[model samples]
Target: MTSNKTDLPYFSVVGIGAGPANLSLAALLQARTDQRIALFDKAADSSWHSSLLHPGVRMQTSWMKDLVSLVDPTHKLSFLNYLVTEGRLFAMINSQFDVIPRREYMRYLAWASGQIENIHYSTPIEEVSFVEGEGFYAISGGAPVARSQHLVIGVGTRPTVPAGLSSLPDDRAFIADHLALHLPTMSSDKTAPVAVIGGGQTGIEAVLRLLGAGFSNIKWLGRRQWFQTIDDSPAANEIYRPAHQQYLQDLTRGTRRRLVEDANPTGDALTPGVLRTLYQANYDRMLEFGEYPVAMLPGRDVTEGVLDGKDVVLHCSTAERLEQHRVAYAVIAVGRQSAPVPFSAELRERLDAGEDGDLVIEEDYSVRWKGMDDHRIYALNRARFSHGIPDANLTLLPVRAAMVINSMLGSELFQIRDELCPVQWG
Candidate 1:
């Protein structure tokens, strides 16, 4: 809670988190010498997909979908560059697929992070508030810093656990986020059944990992009638084309949300290959012995579960009937919620008053706050409702980074037009 007014040599852009999204931004800004930028991560080191990293887990998207290719294909720090540096570029080319092992991808990201300067690791951003006179933000924590230009909040998502299970005492029930670290410690006794909840990518991946770990009995509970596959058709991906940007702009809010919801099953769901692998593994294990019996409890919800002696008694309500299953542990692969960013009382007050609360920005991603015309705060993942589905996911990291950089440079550095799309309608 301290403030300082000193003439600094550089105009700063402060990023709240050091995930792939913010990391991409840091790389883009690093090329510019006139501006100084800083990236902060609360973790001791850079990491992604910590859980669901089974022995053979592969990336759903190709290496071309990395942080820089979609934005700047020519960037030397792209994943292709990392592949070449690691001597895996030729091996990857021979594989005839763009995807690589998840562990290798993490290694690439870590290597890229090391090449960037002014990144503060192990330092968490506690709070960010604006100073009126300076027309800048005061970021407190990890060596006090302030920025006179812009602040990007890319903290990423939080794990979403079921409402009732939050207070459960059993250490056996876990989320997908911690699955990798905790899975190895699990007992391998055949009597212990592992229940995996959810049928999305993370859930399916977790189930496959558990089976790979030699777990005998496992159950998968999902609300969907069956596991869905993402639509990889060229026409479907056309939604990402520049022509569709105008279409997305014209739609109303409700229409835009519906479009996202409808398109999610095809774009964000589990890949067909991953699903096939899971099915094949289940069959293989079943043929050898009744070792990995995957009971697909579709259209079912886990109403209650508690520790009953040495087992977990799970009460589930299916579409037709209520059933119970006893298992050793449960893994909730429910994915994540938006991460919280600390805003000062002054900014929060303006949002509370509903004036400049729903701040609108032109396609450049400049945020409009009350009583502020020149000072713009650029938020990355927080604009999902306005910016479409690409805001939070890694799929749009490169595009978003290019836009942010373009806006900062006050010109079309990437040659993208400034036209805003039509307002979406329901």
Candidate 2:
């Protein structure tokens, strides 16, 4: 077929969302192959998790698990190289922190992004469609802007508010992503009652931020029996390796999903020292005042939230009873859901979906779609059920990218070798 849009820019690969996953893939593709690759993101800049990047808050993963090190340690855009080239190597080491600050990580990402080529920020690819024999076309603002032989969707996740709480007044109740933006206009009275929902790290960080902002009356709610810390032990860390990921790939879908859910405690819980920090801050506030400034309520599952006059009333249930709490404002950090892909209706219908209604992703991360020949679409961070816990995080970022690149090129361009495994997988 003759190309009609010959004047427009064309790439071998067009990746949506230049987040860490896509950034890793783009970096590797640029270094290893002569492939003309381009990445498009809706965000104006590479400020990852910017809203929840509170001061003193640290990353859950180690600095070693950066974008490129796992598969290509010698890559020019490795985190170590970033520190050296940016003149922060000695200072970063001297800090001697358990984990580096997330703000620093964001800076490292932005720095690395600047060095990469053909990354178009502030450009949203609204629709992606596949023409019969012409490959993929990325449409923005109702017109095709770029053509690509391959597509990679890595748009990442967005903070989700529960359906029950979705109707809450937007100004008074909101997701954690907007907490920082809404803090100033919150309340003139520091003691105004507020609630931070969800038991994960984001929820704790919200509580800490409220305390720091001089909020005297704050309630921290969690569905679990208690606020849980991540299992950062040696054994737990081993699950993040490539070997375990491969082991997970061999399991049946149902079995793999169950195992991955079981592994959530290893990475999904609160970061170490975060809960302690919250507790110590509450204690100090208690010492100053007659009572603790923050109230920790665990095992309370918030089922509904409604605006009662100026306050947001949260209806929660416990193991034995139901209760209600009122607060001037609520910051919801329940969890995040995957961002929607911009696939056109025709293309969406042609893709093979799983029992879960998501695209059927193969072991190598490519989506099983109709009419796939030399052109293919790869999905990143969307195969948790088959790829295990590491699929949803920065742990095996480069390794996943390598898998996609190897599968795309039909050769072993990058080798992933995870040796010295102590635990055997069945």
Candidate 3:
């Protein structure tokens, strides 16, 4: 339905997705009350890292790196505040690490979202277009409605399933995203071997979870020699330090992009301690009950897989460079790919063409297009290639949110840009 101008906001900032990145922006706007903002997500409610939420999975970043602390350290809704409210602050301080459980972190995010007003859950922005002279138009749940001023596209990334594996029967195979929720319902009598693809955190976590759940005969296959560890050392995390902000802000765009790609830090992966615990658990189970449910086949690339009779056979080439071995059920955890925005063909064409596209931003988190002089269409996840490493990830979300807000307010709240770090990876 066409919303009346009186009913609609005159200077509204539309947030496309309600994930942590955009949620941080929403929280900032709510805190400042500078502009009329409405945040939307396709999901029914707020969720963070639901796919990898095994019982013991915890955040890789400390609670201090939450939605607002990096931008405004004194923010009340910070993770520290959440821990205090939960009565875990004192105990958490005594622990070696400051991370909270994934479930608890998710709950804290949901709580933060609830406290913010004007956030519309389950409302997905279908398309956004700039109206000549009349600000912008956002087509959400209904007819195209004009929203004056700005728009923020924070839709996030889509799960990256392998190219050949999409045709597999849904009942037989699953992605890491759906495994946790659906694994319990899977048939218990089947002795079929399960193969998990990808060497990333999700793949490792999936293997561990399956073994923990009493599943037998699970194979974890990865194309890489070994899973790469994140640079969590105090010195490395200096990328997020305030001192590095000037360096990042002054670097060239191309250099910034290279730095992000080379870093390739995957969060929430099992630490050395956690990996040891998982190995000990598997070993204990094997020794006590004569059951070894898990096996690691690193440096193996999946060439092909097909449903053979009652079981799925995964053809994999290992480091030994031998022929492929067939296995049943493949869980591809290769991670997500960047998804294109659902804009009209005209807008897409305009974006592809450099003339209008340059006006379309690759820097700062805001989405803007050509011809919309008075309005800016800022993106939360779209400018990763341009804005550098911190755009999509939670690593610099608090700072990114502040930057977007500052851009909207015509202020310089966050001037930190991407800097070219020494090439640590080849």
Candidate 4:
């Protein structure tokens, strides 16, 4: 029934990662509550997708979906305020772009990170364990550095590589996260064959970047019938509204999962701008070389790849036939998987788990774990099925943060009002 302060530095809450999800949570709680919350990240500094901040890459989501706007529009940390305070408001308007640049978003996140009071960088949390009466302890560097009454895990996702390509040496093959870093070495041989795997936005971006870098021979592979652009139409956009998110809760888990899958074009596809940019560039190049530089290979899933001397051989299967392609370099952009939770054995065994060992996320984003008396662990961006597609996107970030804060404080500190439904579903 007692705890000592000398054992570990304590707080009301501790966030595992300082990415967008937890950053939004920290910003809201910092502005509204006196409760002490700290974040620990293994990153050496504050950065979001730093290496992949490609020169031409832009955000798919609007800037209005910033961290605090949906719940607290007037908060000093709004994206509008960031633009104004940083002296870029008019400059941004002059550009007349549909979406902000990814680099700008990363800068906004870094700026927000600096404003938040307690974010411990370069501090890796290896284990998060809960003792019966003492609350949660975040162990770092082989010792418990911090303790908290509650925990929020928002470490984000990691790039994935298939088993066939995983064994390739670092120089020959890697995920797209390292593309920028490898561009110089890659550009040395502009005519060398390059293979990019996966069908999503990342793969398309990789192909586009290689084309921009004067790479002559590039093979772009996709599992789908064709490359797809985001359906950001008004009706499709309505799926990301908070009203739609709540409506999803009433449906069965199986049905909710199906809807999220069907809404893939909204988030998982390429931006129309990027697709058009590639097309125009390809057209211009064809005028000079009499052929397109990048070969678009769709309706084919790359089943395996192997290192053949300095080259990588990719085995792919299409509806009609099987094929093999060789390339000097390979970039695997096959999507991402959620980052692992640093839960200790004692804590992990007690939590309600799904078939995949993930925490069973409740409607409020908190995980149903044992011994959650006054303390809780909230998982952000981990419940795509239950919360709809917006659960894993920037659209409802502030709303989710507000819900978590409201549930944590047991009162309506921040009111979330999504009014006027365009579509009513049973």
Candidate 5:
């Protein structure tokens, strides 16, 4: 009757990656049960997109959508509580920002993580394998750290560089994250032009930072015909509510997928505040220098390119014509793909996946996998097509976490209720 750490009793849950997704789940489940639950993250410290915390850059999502507030407003870990405890509630209210700074969100996450129990930092879970008799063994550091009855994958995303830049040395082109680090080492010549490829918010932010730093020539290229902002209109917001999510559940999978594509502006678009700021900054520069520093190049689908001497050449196809742009540097701000689940080969085969080989996440965020009788696998921020926009957004994090917790416990500890909706969909 003895056991090592590998043979430890089955934990209630083992969450991979202590990002907001799994942190939300850990927060909501704190009071519900005394059963063992823990989060293991590869990062040595609690830093959420640390390098991307550019100055004056704010969160695209609202602060009210903090980890636990949306689901349980009265929860101790609510953002309001964080503000009060840190004695910055009044200062924050006076700032009157449309959205909170991402730095604050990161701090809040770290605070929440500190309060929670059994979070293993710097411990990267190498593989997760399932056995017939046992629940799930999560291996890390060449040993099984814990056995879990349930698994939650929240590995999050990484910056992606296009294959076109593969031939270039690392010194030339890089993802948006390295921009801040690269800036200090760059030449101080103000008129030296740079390019930000990809029209999403990240690209917009990069363009703004360069403009602010006195770069007279900056190219902001996006595939969309024109840069778009998040449509926070009342009607557009209707889709983000739980009622619409329930409606999405009823539609055929194909229809839901199509609608999810159409609902892009709800979360993935640029924020109006940032947009206005960029325009105003550009206008002020025009008044002072008689020309705007930032050039907006929309509808340019950058397919391939090469390094030409001191500059990088980007070949893009616009609707009307094909063109080549040369710049001192290129910043890739394209959208990110989901981080792959670290499921073992056997578990991967047993799990149901779509044509793209992505895990087929169910409505409850659970995956349909064979040989996982009572054990379950829940993926957070990995089901954009299946669960609509909310799947990859922070707007409904706690709600999703609560649903997972309920599913894991086989009881509705938190009743999900969203009534009196204005929009009705088939």
Candidate 6:
């Protein structure tokens, strides 16, 4: 570890993690103001959800909701501009996709990231501390790399496997992201059985990937009674608007949490297009094999797993009774939990946290800390219950960034206007 240095590069804002959230903020700050900004990420290069960009997989949100479009459509880094600049405008127009492919979105983000300035790649910030009079310092490699008046935490979530499956052999049972890496080691026979645990979008995607890999016997398990598609109706979409988010903030904490829980189906379920594609593919395989290649086992809550000879046996509890499934391999796609914010012990003690041990975020996404008079810390993608479902996904990417910018600048840098609301939250 290198020694701490007093003289470090100074910036108006030092953002950790070059994911979509900070990238959105960086693009906006570059376009709207001349403030000194820097973004640091641990990855070697720009990529978004790299492991999960399976063939035929698509984004759940529309293309219009790119990094800088919804708030500042004229921004040079808009998704439309990327296509036009890259000579794919006409091709994209002709494709006429309801939602663009996930690979395409990843490519767009990489392109936009290339145009942004002061983004430090392959640099992982270990801890952030405050110096009282000197603002915030981002420490990396046991020394201060950058100092800034503000810090943004965007070190996105990580895939999680439950405690029961945690002890499973890594070579046999692993997270969904490792499916491709572990696939070739498993059986090459198309009829070999494999199990995909989790019923949400990621689980379905894993099952689809297995199908593409010619795995005829696939067990798809989930806790839900049945595989459910997203609620894509206009009324359901209203939950993602700025108006609904503002109204949610006005309610009591208990009421807001309950309302957000009720609104999960709007954005948390599987995409309708992907579900339809899976159904059609399953039907096509059934026509040739006289039976379905994939067996849908919903309403089963997976409880434990243990090795049985060469097979991994999964024990689950259903609505009726307990059951067991023996498979060659299991892909766990349960869910994701937030990656921790590496705050120094002193700094963390000065900050306020919620009952869930997350930062107490303000309306503008800034944290409620003890000594925030001279400096501030803003967190994105960490405010789902407070900001609603849009906080977790890419639906209102730029709008959220605009709110953070306006709050940082102490002015209406971007006017967020949502009009003609038919539904009354009151």
Model 3: pairs clashing at backbone N, Cα or C within 3 Å: 160-336, 248-417, 249-417, 314-327, 366-378, 366-379, 367-377, 367-378, 367-379, 368-377
What does candidate 1 score on TM?
0.89
Off by over 4 Å in 6: 1-6
Error of 1 at 128 (Å): 0.6
Please identify which of the two predictions, 1 or 2, would achieve the higher TM-score against the true structure. Answer: 2
Q: Residue-wise lDDT of candidate 3 within 1-426, one digit each (tens)?
A: 234545555556877778897889888777876677877677888887676788787666667668887777677779888888879878867775656667877998988888877777766668766555566566776655447677777778887877677777877777888888768777684456788888777787788888777777888787877655666776566555434543455677677667656645634234555566567877987897687667777788877667877577777777676555455567789878665566665665555333424434544544444654567777776555455555556778877788778877888855554455543322
Residue 57 local lDDT, model 6:
92
Q: Which ten residues in a row have the lowest lDDT in candidate 6?
A: 1-10
Comparing 1 and 2 on lDDT, the stronger one: 2
Q: Judge candidate 1 against the unseen true structure and give its global Cα lDDT, from 0 to 1.
A: 0.72
Runs of candidate 3 exceeding 4 Å displacement: 1-7, 86-88, 91-98, 241-256, 265-270, 289-291, 319-322, 352-360, 413-426
Q: What's model 5's lDDT at 238?
A: 86
Listed in order, each prediction's TM-score against the native is 0.89, 0.98, 0.87, 0.97, 0.96, 0.98
Residue 363 local lDDT, model 1: 64
Error of 6 at 251 (Å): 0.9
Clash list (residue pairs), candidate 2: none
Residue 181 lDDT in model 2?
94
For 1-426, candidate 2 gives per-residue lDDT tens digits of: 134677779899999999999999999999989999999998888879887888799898999999899888999998999999989999999999888989889999999899889999888999998887678998887788789999999989999889899998899999988989999999989989999999999999999999999999999999999999999999998899889988988888999999999988998999868888999999999999979999999999999998989999999999999999999999999998899999999989999989989889999999999876788899999988798888899999999999999999999999889999999987
Residue 272 in model 5: lDDT: 89
TM-score of 5: 0.96
Candidate 6 overall Cα lDDT vs. reference?
0.91
Q: List lDDT for all candidates, in order.
A: 0.72, 0.91, 0.70, 0.88, 0.86, 0.91
| Residue-level lDDT for 43 in candidate 4 | 97
Check candidate 4 and list the clashing pairs.
none
